[model samples]
Target: MSVVRAGGDGRTEADGTGRAGLRTLLRAADGVRIDVAYRPGPGGREGRGGPDVIVVAHGFTGDLDRPHIRRIAAGFARRAAVVTFTFRGHGRSGGRSTVGDREVLDLAAAVAWARSLGHRRVATVGFSMGGSVVLRHAALHGGGDPDTDAGRTARTRTDAVVSVSGPARWFYRGTAPMRRVHWLVTRPAGRVVGRYGLRTRIHDKDWDPVPLSPVQAVPLIAPTPLLIVHGDRDPYFPLDHPRMLATAGAGAADLWLEQGMGHAEHATTDALVARIGEWLEKRG
Candidate 1:
């Protein structure tokens, strides 16, 4: 589809399907260009009376074009406008991935762009690594202290937030999937595989001060309407992760321990995504 760029902020509709997609490039806190796709809900743009916007953040090794990612976007589009983007190292975005640390800036930029698009109510839905990023983004931007560069860029103002199959702590390698993930993020050969085989540009260094974990960030998201969905059969993280997040939120968070589900986008059904859309709609 051919997209017309009217200005740095103006979007060009590219999707001919009823769900019109406006493609744009947003700049992250570190000035990395992030590729963004905004799909108008059934109602269309806000000016034309469209529904609120829901930003969908993909997991590790996934991008805007990933089948699962697109499916999530499509599922949300049925209820509200959907914004999907490529994190710094994934798809057509610039810069390498710092895993979940600097990636918060990526989510921040996307949320800020969605707000700039005139959507008064903006909600974020993240999967796996993206799930962790959403939790941190809401905390950092929920009118709290701007401690880091990503925090400074996060003007959260998000109406609601969803975290799917995210880890509670950092440097966790208890599970086989997480162990393999650590190997991919820590070794040179693993980086090569990530860069070539997975098209995910991973960094060699480790977190200096170590960013806030998901459980730590959940409390700050209080009164912001948080939904934490994890699978009982998830191989990456056990039910404890979501339970801890829910506990941290006190009465502010909603936990959905999906039975028989796996992890992230692959395991999340389209019906579940649609249900999430409905939940966001009610929150708005």
Candidate 2:
């Protein structure tokens, strides 16, 4: 488990399970230090050797060491190199979480690192908040070749994007789960609970101009491969959320309505993950 530092970029270590794991720290666009991991596919499928790399983004309160997160990454590792990281305000990353807004920057940093490692292709898989981040990341960083930040952000662009159990809009409090989640995000007591009980540091300020919703982001992801995976039994965001996202994509995205599945990382199965890997292998 000992990792050798390669340079200021990060360090490399062997997981000893036939998967190559490199753990490192990356700075987000705003300079937040993000903890990132690159897990080489078990078959050594890298560079031009495989379809592409997969960058994994976990749900709120989830981190790199979470068993569920690890499982998802492991599942993808069977198909391609995987990148996993802690969002700002979560786990070992510095700065507080702005929920899903600034998270796009964190995701961008991870994708850039994966590309820097020689992986020409990279896909993003995210759950819940992470899911929203992926959609917005693709929209903001995927299109355009401008010379501005939008262009530089292309370093974070992804070939394919998968969003599991993500919400379509912001400020949604329709369901009981979402109501409680709002409580956690908006209440001081809830922030205490998130910091102590969940190990997630939430920011107190709200979005200044408010970022684009997933539905809005999906349309911009056009021509770029997008997959929206939602559970039929999800409590946080109902079927309508995924439907809205799919519709917004205007036939450019694929929607998977998983039967009997619940929500987010905990409810995701290895079979579903493997299926996603198969999609990435072909579509990425």
On lDDT, the candidate that comes out on top is 2
User: Each prediction's Cα lDDT score?
Assistant: 0.84, 0.88
Give the number of colliding residue pairs in candidate 2: 0
Best by TM-score: 2
- The CA lDDT at 203 in model 1 is 76
* Residue 262, candidate 1: C-alpha displacement in angstroms: 0.4
The 10-residue segment of model 2 with minimum total lDDT is: 143-152
* All candidates: TM-score: 0.90, 0.93
User: Where's the lowest-lDDT run of ten residues in candidate 1?
Assistant: 144-153
Put down candidate 1 lDDT per residue, 170-247, tens digits, no spaces: 888889989999999999999999999999998788899899988899998878889999999999998888988999
Q: Please state every model's RMSD to the true fold in angstroms.
A: 3.9, 2.6
